[model samples]
Target: MDAVRPLPDFLVKRYQGWKATTYADNRGWYKRLAEEGQRPRAMVISCCDSRVHVTSIFGADQGEFFIHRNIANLVPPYEPDGDHHGTSAAIEYAVTSLRVGHLIVLGHSGCGGVEGCYQMCEGRAPHLEEKTSFVGRWMDILRPGYERLAAGNEADRMRALEKASVMVSLENLLTFPFVTKAVEDGLLTLHGLWTHIGEGGLETYDPAAGGFVAV
Candidate 1:
């Protein structure tokens, strides 16, 4: 393959600097992680939004978490019909192979994917409704959430759907036989989280409360 263009200088420079500084300071830890392999205690499924910083907020070191990110941070119902599923594959490996004790589905305020789904379900984004729209197809998993949360004004509904998206993923995760078995055997637990970007706040889902409360 030929170069489309030279890589951005700033990104390259930043990586080089971080490699020399942070990695240098943690060389021994990095070497130990590489030799022993990653044994993360938890697996986090979050959105692809650049603003969402899972590691910085958790203050986690390298190899502490098995993280998977996709738009809207969704997980679809399990289907073994010989189809390609990236999120499912990651979850399978994390639960069955890695044996992670906790599985966290992290949603965020002002999620573009959630907003898109809201627009899409309301017949606003025809382009997203098209079959070829990868994001639209992926967000179909969140349609159930929007349907259940169609109350209130647009802004409130969108926010409700954002949290609903996390709930939906947490539910779908249990649809996997392996995941169910792990949870039933007390080998795994499920959690849902929603973050407020500008407010720098996080909230945990309490199944009993049936609503989000600050954390």
Candidate 2:
């Protein structure tokens, strides 16, 4: 294997600074966490976009949330076909093992993964249509959402698709037997959230209103 290089100077400096301040300030809390293990109240499935800061958005402290990030913040339909499933495994662990009270799917504006899914569905992105493309296959989960989207202008359509991604994930979460059991047993609740990246606006899906409303 190739020899590993040292961390970037800026990152190393930032880590040292944090260690001197944040870690030092919370040393006892950190030690307790290490000994007790995590017991987060919620599991958040969020996009892997760097701009979508899940912990910062909620002002979550260390071990407050069990977060899983992936392309488009998606959850695929449960398939116990013996294939590797990273997202499914995380959900199972969060629900069945950690017994988190809430499962949240957090989608955000200007999501490149959602845009790619929209483009692929519209036949405007031939590259993403290739079977060999991992993103294309992964985003196939959102095709139903794309098909359900109403006709609109480009910008509006993209924004709608982003929210649809979150809704689709929420629906897919129910397909997991463990998730279904947890919900039915009143041990877990599911939530769908979307944020406007530029304005820092948050919205939650309201089934009664049949749309997202500002939170």
Candidate 3:
């Protein structure tokens, strides 16, 4: 506590002033969001990493989007019962209840989960109970991607793994009954996106092109 930095009084006062200055627009914003009840047209599937915030990247405010986040932003192949379907539940809620028109799988660079998969394959990490380390289990989803990438040169393998993971997630998204129904009915469109944290580059899935193209 003694070594902790204290807030600058000037900055604190400035923050207080900022509220009053921006009050006109913000005063009813929360209430408006509550009343509107998140009529978002799009649902974003993104990583749970602290660094990758979908709302901040999209410049979206409350009720603007429905979002689901998980390790590597993965959409697991739908399997009923036993397993908790956090991402699927969100997807079902968004697609069925909210009727979102778009579902985006947002991938990013330097992903810890992706890296963990690589490490796990190399026998660098093992399951440790009560530790919450996912190197062993989470990597199961990316096993195919890792194998495909490992067949290539080191540099290419990394890039391929990241891209392939996104592709796999897209495929998995289809396993959900609601998602499949929505897509079949032409009520929903699925997209894959790769984001570079440092460069801020965006690559969007182009089904016609059969690859991710810059967007």
Which candidate comes out best when scored by lDDT? Answer: 2
Runs off by more than 4 Å, candidate 1: 3-6
Q: Candidate 1 or 3, higher TM-score?
A: 1
lDDT of 1 by residue, 1-215 (tens): 57588779999999999999999999999999999999999999999999999999899989989999999999999998889999999999999999999999999999999999999999999999899999999999999998898568888899999999999999999899999999999999999999999999999998789877888
Question: Clash number for every model?
Answer: 0, 0, 0
TM-scores for all predictions: 0.97, 0.98, 0.83
lDDT of 3 by residue, 1-215 (tens): 78898799999998889777765568798678778777997999888888887887888876788888888888778888877778788988999999999999999888888877776776766662224755456658877777766476655666767787898889888888889999999999999999988898889989899888999
The lowest-lDDT stretch of 10 consecutive residues in candidate 3 is: 127-136
What are the Cα lDDT values of the candidates? Answer: 0.95, 0.96, 0.82
Cα shift from native, residue 93, model 3 (Å): 0.9
Model 1, residue 186: distance off in Å is: 0.5
Give lDDT: candidate 1, residue 61.
84
* Every model: Cα RMSD to truth: 1.1, 0.8, 4.3
